[model samples]
Target: MDQTTTARAKGSRKPLWTKDFLITALANLLLFFSFQMLIPTIPIHLSQLGGNNVQVGLVIGIFTISSLLTRPFAGRALDILGRKHVLLVGLTICALTIAGYTYIAAVTLILAARFVHGIGWGLSTTSLGTVIADIIPPERRGEGMGYYGLSNTFAMAIGPLTGLWIMQSYGFSYVLLISTILAILSICSSLFIAYPKPIPPTNRAKSQRFTDRLWERSALLPSSLLLCTAICYGGIVTFITLFGHEAGIPNVGFFFFCNASMVLLVRPITGVLFDRKGPEWVLLPGAAFTITGLLLLSYANSNLSLAIAALCYGVGFGSIQPALQAWTISRAAPDRRGAANGTFFSANDLGIGLGAMVLGAIANWSGSYALMYRFSSTLIIVFLLIYGWSIWSYSLHKKAAH
Candidate 1:
């Protein structure tokens, strides 16, 4: 509309090409790398701490929950605090907490560290998504988002496996130290990105309180949709390694390997669809496939079932994330994009974190992993009900307006 608005939208309007964008993107990649590096080591650490399976699950779930709670505040803070500062603070915290793992022999301290680490994750992740959105054009959004998602995709594809290898070969402390060093490097690279100084109490002058403007009522369908996807995500991210252990296959790598393989196969197509069509086309069907995959996972007894479930879950999850991201982009006002990302992801973290907690409790109480799947599938039905209600209510409003 106006020149100022246009300039802000197109500011540094380049993706992966500019040092500003590249460094910003790479910062996220590195954060995820440092984060995932701890994944394999956690179970090992828990084993040494003499905790049971439930404790391990709680450790993982707390990370998500802590992250989840911070998102709304982070989103609002990003609008108030400025992206680079938030990113820097988050990265610094990540480095410290990651390194802290070496000295934390007590299980309580370890869990506390994870909880604090989540705050950093929420800040960093929300800022990264918002900053990248600032750089990429709407026209190539799907493609740009695809490439952007690659940061996590690559990390997901590689981090845990690599971490596991190093842990087995060197030791947990070395892996934590290596992750600490890389995190420090990420913080340094973050300083390279140029940001216009904020004038006042503004999230880089995008100042708005998240609670005041959250699409709490309007975004029910999309938010519910995101929740469903998150529940499935929780189960996989939280328990797949245990699943491997239970099945006597023990490939912690394959959990994400299968996820990455399918994401690689399907994300480009979903990205194109996201840019061309709207989210509805991508999301509703994606939910079905995700549900099917979880159901299949409930019954999985062999490698074939595992791979099949992964493929299905990957297709489902890979499709949902960008679509929801685009929807958040579409729904928010120009100034509130960061807050929107926060709300969407807060919901995401809540589902994953809380779902894992609930499911973990189920697994703990029942003394069976299969029960986790059954419960997860039951939650899928709850997601469907939420989705159906959301769509119906929106339709009624639309018809009334007409």
Candidate 2:
């Protein structure tokens, strides 16, 4: 009926798949594949290096902590230095650091490499959402983002399984070599995409001191909510193999296989849901799915039960992750989108680190992965309560304002 409404509808019709979008999506795939390939292999490598559960958790988690520290800086760089430049530097760092792993044998050296690797991960990944946001039509942001996120989702499905198979056949060095190649391919892909020109900060924003530039406060709530899921994920990534061994399952790769497949299948639908129904509805079910999966994991005795658990977790993760990221973008001001992404990722990395270390400690103390998983499952319940309270409070605030 209204001219503005008509214009907005037309804008939303802008094509989702452009040349630049394809290049960026491929670049995202390569980047995530390089990282995801190592997710399970690294813990196994650490175990071979004679690390205890706690030490293994620490090594696994320290990467996220390192990445977390660099995210704010990376966000700032994306805004000021430009996305392409920051992304290129990050990719180079990742490629070189991964290559270094082939020569590394000592645990200290391995940890050092992972630390540097995280900086690259933090910088490149922080820019990815920002780049996709810039390219996609604003009205179709949620749908486009869900599609964009599938790059990572698809990689997650294949990466671990491939990496584990390679490690089983060849060695850790070969896995690192393949990861390095993927990172190099990602760098080549990124070069083809024409990145958006960096937006200059406002006069007021420019005047603000260093600390003010460090966060996008508006993104904090969804970021915090995401943290809950990420923590449980870290535990799974870091310890699932050992858990599988304890349960007498010979091949734990099937868990990632099932998990990744479910995520790949469900993510597109969840993206549609975010665009059509909003994030609130998507996130609650996502959380419920994850909790159910974790609870199943705690009680699982057979391969069938484990597969079911993976499927549940995968669907939940697929739904929640993109919706939370879409909500983060929706809440932020345009100029601060990079910062919002950075903040959201930082929260994700922090939760992951905490989960690995904390859950590892629980495993150590209880002497059972089942008990640890049960403990981890409780965290989701806590997060749900917190999320519910926040939603209720926000509703009340809106009513009062009206």
Provide the lDDT at 60 for model 1.
Answer: 74
lDDT of 2 by residue, 193-212 (tens): 89888888888668878877
Global lDDT of each model?
Answer: 0.74, 0.84
Q: Write model 1 residue lDDT over 262-283, tens digit each, in one string.
A: 8877777887676665556677
Instruction: Work out how many backbone clashes candidate 1 has.
Output: 3
Q: Evaluate residue 147 in candidate 1 and report its C-alpha lDDT on the 0 to 100 scale.
A: 67
Task: Give me the displacement of residue 188 in model 2, in angstroms.
Answer: 1.0
Predicted structure 1, TM vs. truth: 0.84
Among all candidates shown, the one with the greatest TM-score: 2
Give stretches of model 1 more than 4 Å off: 1-19, 49-58, 196-210, 213-221, 241-253, 361-368, 381-385, 388-396
Report the CA-based lDDT of candidate 1 relative to the real structure: 0.74
